[model samples]
Target chain A: MMRRREARLGWLFISPAFFHLVVFALFPMGYALYLSFFKWHLIKDVRQYVGSSNYAFCLTDETFLHSLWNSAKYSLLSVPFGMALGLAVAILVNQKLRGISIFRTIYYIPAISSGVAIAMLWIYVYLPETGLLNSMALGLLGEHGRLTPMVASMLGKPDWHLASIDFLNSTQWAMIALAFMSGWGGLGPKMVLFLAGLLGIPQSLYEAAELDGAGRWRSFVSVTLPMLAPTTFFVLVTSTIGALQVFTPVYMMTKGGPDESTNVVGYQIYQEAWVTFHTGLAAAESFVLLALIAVVSLAQFRMMKSTLVGYATT
Target chain B: MRRKTWDKVRGALWATGLYALLIALAAFLLAPFVWMVLISVHPWNTPIPAISDLIPRGPDGQVHLDWSNYGLVLFDPNLPVARFLFNSAFVTLTVVVGQTLVSSLAAYGFAKLHFRGRELVFALFLGSMMFAGPVTQIPVYLLLRSLGWLDSYWALVVPGLSSAFSVFLLRQFFMQIPAELDEAARIDGAGDFRIYARVVMPLSKAALATAAAFTFFGVWTDFFNPLIYTNSVEMRTLEVGLSIYKNSYGGSNWPAQMTAAVIVMLPLLVVFLFVQRYFVKGIMLGSIK
Candidate 1:
């Protein structure tokens, strides 16, 4: 009787949340999977059964494949460099310096700021002549600045000044620009995580390294890098996942333009669902993304478990 | 003694170099925000000034500043930005409060209550976190559309009212609270609800605040949900509304665009400055495990 009463009260406490879980999370996952096997239109409110075609179409679709490729390129461009910068900054700020928290807070501002606002701000930053980067590249005094002509002459493109490049409008530079911004915005959280990892390292290891006649650089390589393996792996997995799902910057800035150069999978899925209104296609595309993420994360997990953990334990 | 003096000199040099590097990195990270703020104060519809021209100089060559864009962006009749701000504030607050309360209740059940299948249910919640948003967004949107909740606060707040991560976070915290306290409350004729409310909730304020802070930041800066769900101008949240404001103003109106951007970003920065401890704690709590 007492157990029955406890179970009844437990149900009462969890029912509201359980209701939400059923309605929002579990139902949606099942429903999305169910919908992927058919052709559905939101406006027409029609669904037709089609076996395996949605997945098959996604696999063969050039635009979808390109988007997946772009997402991979974006992850490669952003994650490693961002993690490097994050580790560098983490090591820099881990010292017992005065007013260090202020710098930490300042570095973190971009991460917490509104993404759309950041995208808009970056559009201005990447503008041809009036943008911040171009202005700096052009020597900050408009076109008459000395470095523009000098650098242009040195690069054998005497007519081509840095200020003349429109980053978002050029297919070659668009993805790189977006990746750079993402790295900037994502650095803070990665840095903080690395800082935590740094703090967790045993001071005895460094002392032992010094006793073995290791210098600062040698100690960093032999001791610090090995100790940071797990943290590095964790950051790597999370940042890669984040880079794959990047949306606002592309949506606001590029709209997958400049010859579909910046059409990431996240934006591609958005276009599929909302713009094209191909609900079934979008569902299938998203499941493909889910599978890709699962595969990548599992691969990384296996790699870490086999190699990094072994190194750390030995 | 000479060697000691040389060591001190080298140490001093190293510290100076480190400080310089830190300051430079800080400036680099902060420059875009500073540029946004400076440009927002420039007069409306003007050509964006060069770096040398950034310091606004009127025709008379006197240093000048324009504050009109703030008024224009906030009170622009066509934009309805103020309404968007209010809508964002309402939805964010409601979701934060509702999610925290519901998560805590469920967390309490998992932490203290003796029930069959408790572990399984909690595990399900944690497992659901791995499901990507894109995989489920379409169905949730369809669900909202079916209920006629799109373009309204219901669509925004209802979908966000329960989070599994928050439940997991609070459950971890609640388990650390001594069970003796609850037992003592039970011995004094307090029911489970009272023990939960009067015992658990008050003691778990730090964890509750951490969960709420994370929720606040996530909801406030959210662009995807607000963008797809809301169709009307007035229904837009600040993040989406800021983008819409930028679109209509056209790219040439840098000053006006920056103003809207600043207005959208400033509140979060301010809130973050004051409550940054909670933010840091919340971030580190999840990752360092």
Candidate 2:
């Protein structure tokens, strides 16, 4: 009798969350899958049954392909750099010293700020004239800098001649600039995760390594690196997924500008659905992105599993 | 004695290098916000100041501060800054409270209740985390359109009431609470709801605060949903409002735009400053496990 009541209460407790999941999450996914097969436009109220044509169109679409490639390139550039900088900062701040929390707080501020705000700030930072980046680069390169003239001469075109290159307008540098901004903004949260992982590492492990005459670098490589495998894995997977879905910066800063060089798959979906009102094509593209993420995540899990097992035996 | 001296020299060198690196990283993280503040107070109708001239001079060669930018942005006819702020606050508060209550209840059930298919239900909730936002963006918009909820607060608040990530985080924390407390409460004839409300909730304050902070931060800073759902200036949140301002008057009034940006960003920064420990603890709890 009590068991029955307990189960009843359990069902009651979960009903609210379950309702939201069905309405907001699961149902939308199901509806998206269903809608992908039809040609639908919300504004025009046009719905026609077109079986797999949307998917076929996406497959052959050059814009879609380029956006996918852009997303992949973005993920490649940001994830590793973000992780490395995060880990470096984490190690630096992990030291037992005075006023370390101040440094941690400074690093974490960008992570908590609005994405649009960061994007806006970076827009100013990347402006060609009087922007922070160009000013700093000019200062670093000195008067008539070697690399500036070299880059200008390499292009060898009269139009390409410039004292300082425009970071956002130039196709060659836009994606890289965006990636650096993302990596910098993302460093805080990633560092916090690494710091947490670092704190969890037992001090005795380092002591034992010291007793064995191991240097600091050796202990870090063997002890700290292996123990942090799980944190590293988690950060890698989450950050890669985040990089793949990046939209706000692209929208706010570049609008995928300077010849569509910065157009990412996520922004492409937005434009298709909202701007062009091609809901069916947008849905198909979303599914394509879903499939790509699943494959990459599963591959990462499999690769990490073998390495984790290797560490366990050793 | 010689060996000790060599070790001391190396240690001092390492400390200096570490401090140098830390300062450099801090500057990289903070320079933009510093510049934003400087530019916001900079006198209008001047060229964008150099890094050296952060505090620009007026035509009179006196250091004239431009406090008018804040007034201009706040009182702008097109922007509706106060209304947007109120909208953002309302939406953020509702989502945070609703998500906390719903996720906590579900977490309690998952942590303590022995119902059939419990593991399966939890697994399903976890699986939903991998569903990217784009996958659901259009369908949810369509669903809202059918329900006649577009350009309304219901569109923002209702769909965001439950989060799988919050549920997972709370469930982990709930599981760590001793079952003996629940049993003791039961012995006193307190039912499951009573124990959940009185016993479990009180003991899980740290986790609850962390979850609330995370939800607050996420909702307050979210731009994508607000942009899509709201059509008019009256309904826009602070993020979308600020972006609209940037799009419209960005070139002519750079200081006003920076002022608006700073205003939008200030609240979360203040909240973060006060309860920073909880924020870090919350992040650690969510990620490390």
Candidate 3:
């Protein structure tokens, strides 16, 4: 009776959540799976069995490969750079400096202020004729090109057959531009998480390291790096998951534009569903996406598991 | 070697690290915004202009700010942003109320009620978080369609009433309350609904507030679902309106396009500043665990 009573109470505490989850989330997944094996049209009453054709078609699709590559490039570029910047900011603000909170707030402004209005804003900044980057590039070119003329003069390369090579169109530059956007948008949240982790670290370790005749850089490497590993792991796992699932900027700014150079898996699923109205194909694509996300996340989790568990229980 | 020299060297390096990181991030974050603000004030529709001058100049050759973009978006017959705003508010408000109340009640049942397979059910809820709408949209649409709710307010309202995060958050909060309180109320001959309403509801304000904020943000920021389901401009949300105008402005109207983006963002900005205290407390309490 005692065991039964305890089990009843536990059951009581978990059922409502289970029910809501089942109806809204779990059921949807099952239903989505069932739908993926068939074809459905919006305005027409047509239902045809396609079996695994949709899945097979994705293997041969050029758009799918492009989207997959773009997503891969974004993850490779943004995750590492975002972490570097985040760690640098976190260490800076960890000091007992005056007016540090002001800097913290200023850095946080971009995350909360994400808007569709950025299209016009970024366009001006990247405009070839009068864009801030180009004008700056032109000035730098006169002074001796850092990276400007090589990129601008890339169309003159005898290697590829292209007349005009715009950044959004050039296969080399398109993903990089998107990666920059992700890195910029991601800085604030990652910085805040690192700040929280830094505060949680004991100050005595640093002082003890200093007393042991460790130089500043050496102490940071020996004490701080290992101590902050857990936080870094957490932030990286979450950000990479988010980076892989990126959809908004591509939709708002690129629309898989300049010959689908910025197309990603998320946008591909969107295009399949919205632009082409292939709900079933989209479902299959989404399942593929879900599997991909799960696999990547699991690999990251396993890799980070040893490093992220805090040392000294600190 | 002087201690003073070492101290000065360390401080300079730290400052260098601080300034470089902050400035780079701020430029990245702020550049688009700065560009957006400038474009909103610019006198063209193009993101790029062919003119020799990048900066705005009035006919009198003096630099002057233009306010016509706001007037055009607000007053133009070709666009009805007011309708979109109304649609957005209605959808958000409805979702907030429905998600909060239903999710709360369901959370109470999970946190308090007893039956079979409860743990399995709870496990299922956690598993569900991994699934995004790409899987569910068609099924849900079919469900809504069968009920003849396509392109209607019910289509948007009914499906979102059970936010998984809200239910989970509320369940956690509800679990923290002592079980003896419920036992005492039961001894007083209180019905289950009375026990929930007169007792549990009064104590769960923080969790409910968290649910409200989450629901509000989800609904307000949402565009994809509404865009798919909604057929008419009247029923379309502000984000959709902002998207349509981004392409349809039909001229070098970068400034006006920037104005549109700013206007779409203004409400969330205002709400963020207004309830920032509550939002921070609520979301952190709800999620970080």
Instruction: Pick out the ten consecutive residues of candidate 1 chain A with the lowest summed lDDT.
Output: A140-149
Which pairs of residues collide in model 1? none
* Candidate 2 lDDT, B1-289, residue by residue in tens: 9999999999899888888988998989999998888889986545678777778678898887788888888888877899988999999999999999999999999999988878888887887887646699998998998999999999989988999989989988999889998999999999889999999999999899888888989999998998898898899999998998778875566677678779888998998887677767877877855
CAPRI-style docking class of model 2 based on DockQ: medium
Alpha-carbon local distance difference test for all models: 0.88, 0.88, 0.71
Better structure of 1 and 2 per DockQ? 2
Which 10 residues in a row give candidate 3 chain B its minimum summed lDDT? B280-289
For model 3, what share of native contacts is present?
A: 0.43
Compare candidates 2 and 3 on TM-score and give the better one: 2
Write the residue-wise lDDT of candidate 3 on A33-131 in tens digits. Answer: 887888866457476899988888776778886777778778989899889988887777767766676676666555565345454455555555356
Better model by lDDT: candidate 1 vs candidate 3: 1
Report each candidate's C-alpha RMSD, comma-separated, in the order given.
2.4, 3.0, 5.2
Quote the lDDT for B235 in model 3: 79
Residue A155, candidate 1: C-alpha displacement in angstroms: 8.3
> Please, what are the lDDT tens digits per residue for candidate 1 over residues A1-314?
98999999998888888889989988898999999998998788799999889999999999999999999999999998899999999999998888899888888888888898899899998999779998787773236667656666777876765446799999999999999998889888899889888888999999999999999999999888888888888898888877888898999999997899999999999999998889999999999998898889899989888877678577
DockQ of each: 0.70, 0.75, 0.40
**Candidate 2, position B89, lDDT:** 94
- For model 1 the TM-score comes to 0.94
What is the DockQ (computed on Cα atoms) for candidate 1? 0.70
Relative to the real complex, the DockQ score for model 3 comes to 0.40
**In model 1, which regions exceed 4 Å deviation?**
A1-11, A140-144, A147-163, B178-192
